[model samples]
Target: MSRPRKAEDPIRLPVPCNRCGQHHQTVARWPDGGVCGYCYQQAKRTRGICAFGHEGVLPGIIDEQPTCRRCSGIRLNVDCVSCGAEDELDSGGRCWTCALGNVVDDLLTDPATGAIAKDLIPLGATLKSMKRANSGMTWIRQKHVTAFLRNLAVAPKITHEIFDQLPDSRTREYVRGLLTEHGVLPQRDELRMRYNNWAA
Candidate 1:
């Protein structure tokens, strides 16, 4: 007999999702129907008059019309296979938090080694564990942010000197602040530290 499938495992057989009309990994299945993770989440949040004449979150599809949860009795919980989060998942079967973590990891990884720079692991961990999932997700998608990260990943070394030599901009400074805060770069106010050292 085939091994029993876990509930967390997404049905990734590539079927057209009934909700979004995309042929992708479907997480929820009903009678000749399937819903992808993205659509599943959208459906759950949808508020409209369902086919049964009820006004609320219309999370079910019945005969090509939106249906109430009570009327449809559709089950929507599909734990993210990556982090086991019961929250809504992305097309890749990962929750928002896990997806953000992956994005951070990918950005931090050194292009040559296919792993995060040793000096930057702390920053990677810090970014991956950020509490606001939505903010982190949105922040990393900026073109400048991605460009800066890719440049950093290919660098031979990471240090204050390296950052200082780069062009000055708010984006660069912001990323530098996080690096210092997370101990990836040594925390030092160059002027202040120099003054204190000279005084000593």
Candidate 2:
């Protein structure tokens, strides 16, 4: 004695595909799964290949041609800063020549003093400017030079006064040592502690 089946219950039966003639079990009959999965995939792949001749899944179809991600120019290309020559840019966004041009060197030396030109110190023109006679250094301006000289003239007096205000001799000597190392003062043993470990 079996119970009657409900009308809403899904019906499953082997239905032959109209295209490929392969049989598959499906519930719906109206919009029949008449095309098998394999046939559908094959039809999709028949569209076209990319310009690079790769036969696989493509991201988009452009100008009636299929294209992959790599062929579409999606990857970024960074250029050199100075010459705009190389594809790979260095850390400072410049090529080797442009980066090396900024380095402090003997090229900026004064013929008279045999030292780095006084005008090139403390935010002055970079070594790159020395190469050009007509063009000026990009980093510094005439007004900046004026202001820098004014400040430089006053710095030593201010430093001396500050050192005089320090309470102890040891602290003063330590500061003097730092100043001497930086070329702000002449090197001398008087600016350091007199005692040595081996002294008896």
Candidate 3:
């Protein structure tokens, strides 16, 4: 006769319900998350409504994420091309502030520095057309003082050293303040510090 049957023998297979909690018996382990034929059928019924509230296929249904909407969505935090700061709001690939008119300014004018400021218009026009996402050279070219060195004291990078040296007696403060207000520079303090450093 065979040996007495052992009543307390451990089972080799895991309990089915224990595998998937609610649908354990119907769920078979797959290379991905899990494979529940029953769950798959349910998901198919719920397809097309993106879980993200957008009008598109639900992400991760077929084990993949869906493409986001072109407009009205956050991309990621990034630095502002004009300000060199990461305080911009992502609206797709570009920041909302950049998309808006935060970097445009009327031409600078002052009776005292009128002639030299007029000479600076060419570089100003070039910067006006430059795209926010492109290189900063267009902005940099404005620093050269070929026509008149007396009016401009700033460098290409618009460093603190250069900004501060701007003759306070001239319209530089007003012009720089205008640029700062328009988002051409990061802030008034940054421009002011540069101006102060240069003055020192």
TM-score of each: 0.57, 0.19, 0.21
Q: Could you report the Cα RMSD, in angstroms, for every candidate shown?
A: 12.8, 23.6, 20.0
> Lowest summed lDDT over 10 consecutive residues: which window, candidate 2?
1-10
The residue-by-residue lDDT of candidate 3 on 50-156, one tens digit each, is 54565532213322543222222323234456545343233444443353323222222333543324334444544445564233322332443211233342234
Model 2, 1-200: lDDT tens per residue? 12332322123525564444555432222222344444433333332468888654443334645554356432323346767743333457764335545432333344455555343352223324354311232322344432332343334342444444444444345545545565655555552324431353
Q: Local error of candidate 1 at 93, Å?
A: 2.0
Model 1 quality (TM-score): 0.57
Whichever of 1 and 2 has more lDDT, that candidate is: 1
Predict model 1's lDDT versus the native.
0.73
The candidate, 2 or 3, that scores higher on lDDT is 2
Comparing candidate 1 with candidate 3, which one achieves the higher TM-score?
1
Which residue pairs does candidate 3 place in steric collision? 160-194, 163-194, 163-195, 164-194, 164-195, 164-196, 164-199, 165-198, 165-199
Candidate 3 stretches with Cα past 4 Å from truth are: 1-154, 190-200
Off by over 4 Å in 2: 1-74, 104-200
What is the full ranking by lDDT, best candidate first? 1, 2, 3
The alpha-carbon lDDT assigned to residue 166 of candidate 3 equals: 56
